[model samples]
Structures are given as C-alpha cells and as structure tokens.
Target: MPRSMTLLVLLAGAFLIAGAAALWLERGNAMLLDLSSSVSSFMCL
Candidate 1:
C-alpha cells in the first residue's frame, strides 16, 4: 500500500510538471505570433 501511494504521488507530480510546461510553451508561441503580426502591419504602413 505504501509503495502504491508513492507511485501515485510521483505520477501526479509528473502530470503537474507536464501541464506547466505546456502552458509555458503555448504562451511563448502566442507572444511570437503577436510580435510577427505587429511587425508585418508596421511594415505595410
């Protein structure tokens, strides 16, 4: 039972880390897209 509990805790930690990493990556992508769009509009003007 103790071993199973430990395994569960580890799995939970892994999932949390993965979620945080995905969120960070998505935010970075959005920032890049926004910058690119702004640059294109400025160039057009």
Candidate 2:
C-alpha cells in the first residue's frame, strides 16, 4: 500500500511538472483570442 501511494504521488508530481512546462512554453499564445477584442487584456486579466 505504501509503495503504491508513493508511486501515485510521484506520478502526480510528474504530471504537474509536465503541465506547467507545457503551459509556460505556450504562454505567449494561450488565450490570446478567446475573448472579444474589446475585452481582451494581458494574461486575460
């Protein structure tokens, strides 16, 4: 049980890291046009 829990934790961490990296790489283009031009803002803020 402990081993499986550890593996699950490691997998979760790896997925999180991978997702963060992907988002960082695509940050410049992400959500660029999701909103209307009048409502668009930097970082969607």
TM-score of each: 0.61, 0.56
lDDT of 1 by residue, 2-34 (tens): 999999999999999999999998999989899
Model 2, C-alpha of 8: deviation from truth (Å) = 0.1
44 Cα displacement, candidate 2 (Å): 35
For each candidate, the alpha-carbon lDDT, in order, equals 0.96, 0.77
Candidate 2 lDDT (Cα, whole model)? Answer: 0.77
Q: What's the lDDT for residue 17 in model 1?
A: 100
> In candidate 2, which residue ranges exceed 4 Å CA deviation?
28-45
What clash count goes with each model? Answer: 0, 0
Error of 2 at 32 (Å): 16
Say which candidate scores most in TM-score: 1
Clashes of 1: 0
